[model samples]
Target: MKKFWKWTNLTESNPTERILTLNGTIAEESWFDDDITPQLFKSELNSCSGNITVWINSPGGDCVAAAQIYNMLMDYKGNVTVKIDGIAASAASVIAMAGNNVMMSPVSMLMIHNPATVAMGDHNEMQKAIEMLEEVKESIINAYEIKTGMSRAKLARLMEEETWMNAKKAVELGFADSIIEPDKKINEDEKEKNKASDSILFSRRAVSVALQNKLKSHYLANAGANTGTDITDLEKRLNLLKP
Candidate 1:
């Protein structure tokens, strides 16, 4: 099982500064149905104090669990900085709202949409479900409104459309405090990777940006996974389906 939360500060010598990673799903592994309850999360969090840095990459999970984590970070005595290195969508976006300073990587994404669940029942049950979903959505708006100060009506519209935002858009929308700046110093190896990476974009990233709206959003294979739906694969599949 992958550990969703871990203390990243290898040397635990300083209580005043801490680093933690909140990667993968917000709470646990969905494919395996693994669980990380709020109670257990608190047990780990209670030990840390002062400024904390959290690295997030999640497709999101149980809203209740995310709510607990969000509240925990919001109420923490010291500063909390959140860095979105990949994707933060659904409940993970809720958690992102808790950050005192939320920074998104250059190409990272922050997605916001209506909450959903599986319900099995009849007319009365369906009405009850709708009512419940409406209330849950209102609660979610509270987080977004606090962070962005956007009007409820506008926020509702964005949620209804399942908005997908890149780092720039995220900051412009007030969902992110700022875009992360590239490190000033990079070794030769790192510089080589950066220099070569963009030269080969056509082989991987061409048109992926424009197609983000087409797919809404695809779940991260796992928290740390950076792979996206390849355009070639998508085109091939569409060709097959049309015939």
Candidate 2:
């Protein structure tokens, strides 16, 4: 299925102040979703009246749409600042660079990769797809270089490897400026440990049940309720779902 962009304003401090937000996939289709955003961006630029804040949280969708937005931001005379509240991946990362000053949450992530395309056809069709992808990659790489002042070769390598950088790494690599402190400290390591424990516990229960059935088959024994297998499975599943 073709992906379409989504946008919604989560917060607006003052009614009179102009704050334009574009959230979700930054694809070409997003322009059609609501011409209001693009028009507002243009209007603000033409007016050159107030500072504009653009908040972006997206996985990124289309390249063409991103380029259009980037150009508009570059043309604007007013102050432009971009905030990355959640994530800015793929083309969205490029859009984030449009901001005169970019801010990313400490836990936020930014990702970049060579442009991708899907195709189903013969060798010629496959070759065409590869060529298109290469061209798109070049365009994206150029944009990154312009924004981060990074070497084209290095950025291209990072894109080729589909690098995902967190806020700290982003700042270190010059993709982002500063890390905004969140209300609460996040411990991703603890979360990952809990996830691994749950997975292992579930697998143990599943294997235990199979073993129980084998024992019963050979000994003509009934595995009573609250057997090791049942208790283990119940406890494991419950623990896994708990908040």
Candidate 3:
């Protein structure tokens, strides 16, 4: 069966690193009838011997799944690095917290909110659901508080508001550790020689992608922009920058 969550160790260089790409909805799409459970994630974690970089782009899912993933990541022997390539929200945000270092593209987004549930019963059942949800919300806050060191009250309020933050805002609020730098060109021969098979090279490449993104944003925001450069000069500069 096809796997929704991809886990692989990039073991072709000096210091191998694991690459886990988590796209789609967390626990929403299952490859097997009952996969992506804690045991499954634990098994995958056991396979890797070094640091793992998780690339997350998800709208979140199954709080329990997120909690399990978060715990496994925290328990891993090697450092956990998270990169938000697109969006991390709801349960997915919880997984992001497992990161010893979290990075996001300038355009990426992070979202947090109170947990919810559906219960069918009398008033007692309704009340039970509320209590359960409250407990879950607290658990979610634990992750956020540890990462941001924000007071529980403020964090709760943000969650209550379902606050969504851009990469810069995420960093300012302490959800993300850093923003990717703008994209920069790398030499073909040097790139081949430094092919990203190790943590150091992989990291360098991540930064390069960040820088490249920033460069694109800069060019778009400055297109026909009248900062100080004139039109003809701007055109010339843009032409010169063209690859």
**CA lDDT, every model vs. true structure:** 0.76, 0.70, 0.79
Pitting candidate 1 against candidate 2, the one with the higher lDDT is 1
**For residues 1-243, what per-residue lDDT tens digits would candidate 2 score against the true structure?**
233322232336643345666676665455646666567656645564556677778898777778777888777776778888888988899888887888887668888877876798999999999999988889888778887999999888788657777776777777877767567666998556533123211123344557655755644454444346554465566557432
Ranking by lDDT: 3, 1, 2
Top candidate on TM-score is: 3
Please give, for residues 86-203, the per-residue lDDT of candidate 1 as tens digits. 9998899999999999998877988887888778799999888889889989999999999999999988878876778887778877899887878776688875664412321111
Candidate 3 lDDT trough over 10 residues, lowest sum: 195-204
Select the stronger candidate by lDDT from 1 and 3. 3
Ranking by TM-score: 3, 1, 2
Question: In model 1, how large is the Cα lDDT of residue 53?
Answer: 87
- Candidate 3 clashing pairs, residues 3+ apart or interchain: 181-210, 181-211, 182-211, 182-212, 183-211, 183-212
For model 3, the stretches where C-alpha displacement exceeds 4 angstroms are 11-15, 29-36, 185-243
| Residues 79-162 of candidate 3: C-alpha lDDT, one tens digit per residue | 889999999999999999999999987678888878987699899999999999999999999999999999999888888767
Candidate 1, TM-score vs. the true structure?
Answer: 0.71
The TM-score values for the models, in the order shown, are 0.71, 0.63, 0.71
Residue 76, candidate 3: how far off, in angstroms? 0.5
**Better by lDDT, candidate 3 or 2:** 3
